[model samples]
Target chain A: MNYPNGQKKQINQQNKSVKTNNNIFSNRGMSLEEDINTTNTYYLETDIAIIHKKPTPVQIVKVNYPRRSAAMITEGYFKQASTTDYNGLYRHRYIDFEAKETKNKTLFPLANIHDHQIRHMEKIVKHGGISFIIIRFAAYDETYFIPAEKLFPHWHDKLNGGRKSISYEKIKEEGHIIPFHYQARVNYIKIIDRLYFH
Target chain B: MNYPNGQKKQINQQNKSVKTNNNIFSNRGMSLEEDINTTNTYYLETDIAIIHKKPTPVQIVKVNYPRRSAAMITEGYFKQASTTDYNGLYRHRYIDFEAKETKNKTLFPLANIHDHQIRHMEKIVKHGGISFIIIRFAAYDETYFIPAEKLFPHWHDKLNGGRKSISYEKIKEEGHIIPFHYQARVNYIKIIDRLYFH
Candidate 1:
């Protein structure tokens, strides 16, 4: 399928062992990450907002200074970020969020997010900034914009002997459904406008 | 010298040819950066703020998958960041800024800051966030927290065929002088609280 962004969405092959929801339109190859990136780029290119996905943090252990120029990192490790994958200014407000994709149709596991990330989000919310998660049920090719408030309960519940994951049905009912667009594939900001701006 | 952070300040060797102000007590080995990093860490541990310096952005060109584990990047290049060095949430507002040090005591060169970074700061300011530069005049061992508003005129001057830098005398008059603290060496946030909160 061709998106308004003028890019053709490549359908990805599915595994027979996993449950597939054929009812929803699947734009498989363009992962949830790619969609969000594309959306952010569009947002930036237009001057709507100055949002950016932070570069994957790397801890450089060793570097080689071959000349009086840019030092080349020789040894490094992909440092697990203490914060979210993306954060930037939106509508004059601080915005922070994480995006994840799961094949499971019934549940979105809390394990996909790190403990530090939860704390980071909690701080943003406490400070009155916006925090959220973008989850893609890849099997069904559906995505949802769920605020941090909806997510915090699931994290706390794990300790209270509650379900370790949020049921898809619960999320569908509580979360804002992100519509797929031709240009802005996962246009999550539309929901933000309604939730916060209005 | 032992700082209030309970750490010894490591003095960096100075280039003799460069300008040095002997009257200002120089923590010779401890660069301005080390002080700021130490301060930030202290802030985080004390639950003051969750600010962080974004890792230097690097572009990975080649990677080697030696085993079924971590991918080792064999080739990469440092990418100039379009945004500033540090940013985070402060009192429910987005804070973004850059830090620069200069040996020249008379002036803070406009060349040190990029054009895009100025634009980035402008956007942050326009969106109700705080944006500024923490300029450390090494010779004087003096740092100034100048808001984007104060810095913008200097940027615009260059385009109008005016002088391309801000003189130290002018900066001293216009900027908030950041006092050197034992623990929070670059306590720029104190100025923020004064300027924004008060």
Candidate 2:
């Protein structure tokens, strides 16, 4: 289904995997967000990469202080992020990218991204910063890293009144399939080493 | 005076500079926060450095959408930041720092920093990141870049039940004074160069 503004809503789209009833999933071991976070922590610990997930910005109103030291955030709403979730220095270069997961088995909808974020990513690329989007096809159990440069053409085409999103088949052909490893969970830098550094 | 918990109020006394109007005596020129942000932007534009101020973490409790496309934050409270404001890459080294301004002429009080933040700074330094604090004495229009190594000893002394803060005099003697420039504004990288690079 398309949003009235022709964009797909995903930012706060509660993952069905995170079952509200008891917080148990179909034994995928860990949620996509949790695994990526763990991988980032591991990267930081090993001095491999210094990426960090920016905390979800929340608009907090109405706090209750029952005790002097205890403050409860009684009311708050999540704010839209101005930039991607992850960024940091890697191998002396600025690394910035966003992580996304989709359950679609066919075409990976381009509707997943907001226009402003695409523009922001473009700015990072223009300034010689390494930029990309990490896409995980949950149904296929595969993840791909699509370089910003490659994604830019498609983004431009949309601006020229073309299709606004990339297809899953196109991503499979152009994007680097991130290898899964026990240690470097996402192992995105391997793609970086070949694409940007090499 | 001692607080109800028998913990000496120490430096927790009311900021004597708060005027009868409940407004702190802000500097006549741009605030330190603004100055640092300007300097970071300049650095980014010139490719001299790639530092950025982390967005102030706010918990939004309420927002009034008086008109479409306009979000007016009606109620919110600021949250403590988990990382330093300024962090990015410089000449293949990870740079991380926090900037604070004080009106106090006698001493640059340590009460301004939380213990957890000090611990975080220490971790950054331990991991080989160039970490420091930019302290602007707004009243005198003087700013100093104090290395994390120097600040650590004083921070620990308080934990050992010694002095609770570092004096302005000590900072004047030990910290590198940052020179101002038309373009660089804060020119803190000059201090960083002399202290770390050179």
Candidate 3:
């Protein structure tokens, strides 16, 4: 059975899993980005939210427009993003967040996030938008939602010659654990509801 | 005089204009995108609003890791954007909009916007976000902000075998004219202030 253009890749992936006899659990080893993307798709389809991950920023320096083919980017470089990754509207509220996963068992380093992104989140919170970060402990298979307000004091401490990272235990204490659902794998919206709504 | 990396382009453009003796006005022939970017920067600096044009989406096919320099995208194709060109939080409201400039003197063609973008804008409006489109008539140097609600009727008409374009006069009557300012070039936030905040 042949699939259309967009569905082809998905069908091929499933086939590969089937060939490996790994069909029982489809999302066993999915990356954090893939899980969030799948969760976002489910949210959009169910009309629960309209969150979207912004595309990776690239600076195009050269292009090759063949006579019959699409315009191909021949030279490009990645640029530092000026804002958070995921943002949209949920329950009539502006929602913005960045998601990161760390393989370390003890701590999540502050260096994973950039300075300008922290400033951007501060502005978002000041403007009354709901801003947060999703931190995933890959070793423990646990994800936590930490509000921008909660992360700021730690960032300031690091700037003032304090610890360079947030301990896993500290995150477990301060952050809300995001439960995984089959459809909404990351399921950060549940945490948003608890934080922002009643 | 040596300029920083990002400042080099602006300095070069200014020097070119000076050499040609066309330095009376720096923004005489700027595109709508450039104007809006400048306006957003001004708004950000003044702490008035937070808006940003999302980066152009590209489907990267291949990349190369050089010995000492940056990773280069050797092959890629532009992807159709799934949402509006710009979205951000303003005065606690989620602001979303698409900007387009046309050389057509009498009408703005509906083909410039995609079906998915229209659906995206509709979802935004239904979710209580402020959604609109910025239509610029380059021939007359006039830009108008048409609310998503106002555009829906015209889009439906086109879908029902009616006129394929919205007349310039119709847009002028239905849309708010965005005033030009020296710093905030497009200045759509002024129109937003009147439409929503008031």
Candidate 4:
């Protein structure tokens, strides 16, 4: 049953033992965030790579004491993050990157990023850190890792009356495509090995 | 003015600036966190190194709106941080570390760190990142950078009835003493250069 338009329903929908006749039944179950979290967990469990999704930043203002032990949050608001979603160390080098998923097939919109993120990436690159963007066109099941240096021209051009997005064709040519697997949904380390190591 | 138990009067007596006679106050009147932030700003500006203090984590539960545009955070609680306070890149090498200040002149207590943070630092070192702890004997105006390899043994020794603290004298002998300038309160990169690069 659907709730009112503005109300969010909290449901525990984790039961998965039922026999399903169609692939859509299984596919319809998982949310994008859940799948990505699972992939990150898998990455962490294995010695493959060390990257983490930064927790959403929230500004807390008040709290209520329900009991001696269980203090509950009473008030808060979401805060804009100054850094990218993912950053970690890999193979003796600093890895800093932002991950974005788009449903659009034609182009990845520049509006997905903020100006502060661009400046942060610029600083990261200037300091000799490996910085990039991980763009996932989920509609096409395609993911690409584009270096920040390559994206800077597009960012500047977008400010000067160019297209406000990077077309799929440009990504196909410029960015390294990441291979997907059952465990590593966005196996970006492989792309790093191909581009930076070898 | 005096507080109920004379606490305010005692604190007020100690509130006078220690450098009242000097023209310059080194490190300013900032907390350890703020001093690191200012040092990071100086590092970023000078192309010396890149470092940042992670934002405090808060778990938000509710928000209120009395007006159209002004959102008031009414309920929230601070979540204890799982990672260290600072991390960054230096000379293409990943750097991960935590900074702690203690008033105890004889020993630096290990109770300031959590188990998860130690685990995080271990992962960082395993993946080729430079991991360390920056301990400040604030009473003595002394800061030292102790590498993770040196810390791990102490962590394990605590389980075997050994001392749960590292003495300042031991740190002075074993760890690298980080020099302080008027700008960089925790000038760790100099020690890093002497230890890692040189």
Candidate 5:
């Protein structure tokens, strides 16, 4: 079926299952971002939550006003984000967080996060928002929801000349494992529902 | 005087007064956006609120990575926003809003708002977020805070064979007039506090 904009129905496979394709399907299925987008779409459709990954910020240096229609940016540069990439209102509360995927199976490096992002998360926390980080170990096919509260201590330790990364064991111990759901792939909100709201 | 970024101590005049240079200072003052940003900064500094204007969204088509320190976006376009430009956490409540300025003094044409923005505001209201529009009549030097609850009705009316523009009288009657403070220029949050929190 073709729509006006060639819009196709999104294949939101909540459950990790497909026909005649086990390992091959699982490996090529979805990225961490795709999973979260699918999950956010489900939450929005069901009136459970409303969250969105903000559009990538761009600084346009030049634009052309081609007669009729919207203006076109001819020259631009991607600006370093001063805050996290995702934020929204959930259950009448502000929810803000960042997501990262690393192939390393042993640890999630602190270098994955920037100093300004840490400051932004801290501000969110201080202002009574639910803040967290979603760290996915792509090598192990595991994802963890590490709350800002759990991760801040490790971040603060850097000032005291500490380890620059959180060991995988530490993440598993401190963070809640987000299980994949049939209707909501990479259901981090399930962990949030259990940890924060409960 | 020059403290790195021309930083100066903000004088948050809650009652909107300072000295003899009333009209003079007001004429040579900051824009609505600058006021909001400075206000957000003050709020962050004083631990009052944590809101930010999401960076402008740009769609990058091509990038030149010439083994340099940064990549330059060679082809890009400014994308229309699917959601409001500013959002944040305020007193544990999710707050989101869009700002617009018009030189017209009478009616605010519905053309200024897109269909997607109306839909986005509807979702925010449904999801229990405080959503609003800051309509500044630059000609009249007046700013009004129109809540989603009120604006959505007018938006829906347009779809139901109603007027495509909202008259100035109607807006002033329904919307709360936002007073311009010295530091917090467009103090729409004051109206938010009264309507949502109070």
Candidate 6:
């Protein structure tokens, strides 16, 4: 409930929408990004870890400065990010990851990720950082944490004219289910603890 | 010279300005941010590190989506960053730092850095991540890598109504001068090697 300025507005909007829809289980209606952001905030407040969702990239073309008000961007376009969505320090380890949720129950499409992002994740892993992807099957209400190393083979296969998506069965076999908590909604760090720390 | 899209445009603008000013020492003309970015690109290309400068944060207030056109931000405001400007993996460690340049030769003023950034750096150090500030004395043509630990005392002093700035002589004694090079222009990793890896 103690979200920061910009995030507070977003949570309030979501709450309003949930009320309008009369959704009894409002917690389950949160998007993956919102859940992760809340989880990161909880980790930051408790001094457990420091992770953040990088701001959406924007290419500003024009701005106007009023007499006293803050400079306003009058013209800008969204830019495709060259790196993953989230990254920060966790348990003295450099952590980086991308989160994607799909309505399709059968597969997670590779088109959701860019080639540069795949290469970035590759470099992160090679440099001894913890890298992964959080895949949410919205239809099943399940989120999986798949390590970067586990993902590379599938990405390579796609590049070599193989299946362009990872099957749900394959993901379930290779990935760890991220537990949902009241505070740390998408508790991916718990998976990291089991995989790397312990 | 292999700068990315937005950065290439900026470098071109800087080059044009330098030419107009007839500043012969063009290498020294680059801003602290540009130098660090170039150095980071070099490190990434050479597979030495995976550090990156986070994109400038912006808060979007309005957007226009014309048919068959990319969505444009019609109204936006710059947002204060919650963390340091630069952060990523370096030598299997979490690297986070802020870069600042001052024209004053006598001392580096404390006002250039925000209080929250100081707190963020403090937390980074506590979590065993590598945290520091890259300070450029534009008047002296020197860039120094001041460890977060070394900076805490001065920041605390400012909080306690002590000197509002750290003098140039004190910085010379406590901070390591980041060597300038053709590829790794700022060459901050050299200082990290000497201080941490050695």
lDDT score for candidate 4 against the true structure = 0.78
Query: lDDT ranking from best to worst?
Result: 3, 6, 1, 5, 4, 2
Tens-digit lDDT string for candidate 6 (A1-198): 334567656657787764643343334588999999999999999999999999899999999999998999999999999999999998899999999999999999999999999999999998899999999999888899999999999999999999999999999999998987778989999999999999
Better of 4 and 6 by DockQ: 6
The most accurate candidate by DockQ is 6
Best model per lDDT: 3
Scanning candidate 4 chain B in windows of ten residues, the lowest lDDT window is: B18-27
iRMSD values, candidates in order: 1.6, 5.4, 0.5, 2.5, 1.5, 0.7
TM-score for chain A, candidates 1 onward in order: 0.84, 0.82, 0.87, 0.81, 0.85, 0.87
> Candidate 3 residues B2-95, lDDT tens each?
3357665675678765544322233358899999999999999999999999999999899999999999999989999999999999999999
Lowest summed lDDT over 10 consecutive residues: which window, candidate 6 chain B? B18-27
lDDT digits (tens) for residues B48-119 of candidate 6 = 988888988999999999999999999999999999999999889999999999999999999999999999
Cα lDDT tens digits for candidate 1, A48-136: 77788888887766777888787787776677888898888888789999999999989999899999999989988987789999999
Task: Candidate 2: list runs displaced more than 4 Å.
Answer: A1-29, A60-67, A71-75, A196-198, B1-31, B38-50, B56-80, B89-94, B110-130, B149-164, B179-198
Q: Please give the TM-score that candidate 3 achieves against the real structure.
A: 0.88
**Can you list the residue pairs that collide in candidate 6?**
none
lDDT of 2 by residue, A1-198 (tens): 223463234422656523441123121455567767877888877877777777666656566767665455655666777677787767757788888888888766677777867876776776667889998888776789999888888978988989866788899999988876565677888998999788
lDDT of 5 by residue, B1-198 (tens): 122342223322323433334443452345668767877887777777888898877777888886855777877777778788889988888999988887788999998899988888898888788999988888777889999899988988999999999999999999999876666777777998899878
Each candidate's fnat, in order?
0.44, 0.09, 0.80, 0.68, 0.83, 0.86
- Model 5 Cα shift for residue B149 (angstroms): 0.7
lDDT of 3 by residue, A110-144 (tens): 99999999999999999999999999998877889
Please give the distance, in angstroms, between residue A20's alpha carbon in candidate 5 and its true position after superposition: 4.8
- Candidates' TM-scores? 0.84, 0.68, 0.88, 0.82, 0.86, 0.88
Show pairs that collide, candidate 4: A74-B74, A74-B75, A75-B74, A75-B75, A75-B76
Candidate 1 local lDDT, residue B77: 69
Tens digits of per-residue lDDT, candidate 5, A32-102, equal 89888988899878988888898887777888889986777777777888899899977777999999999
TM-score, model 1, chain B versus true chain B: 0.84
Task: List the candidate numbers ranked by DockQ, top first.
Answer: 6, 3, 5, 4, 1, 2
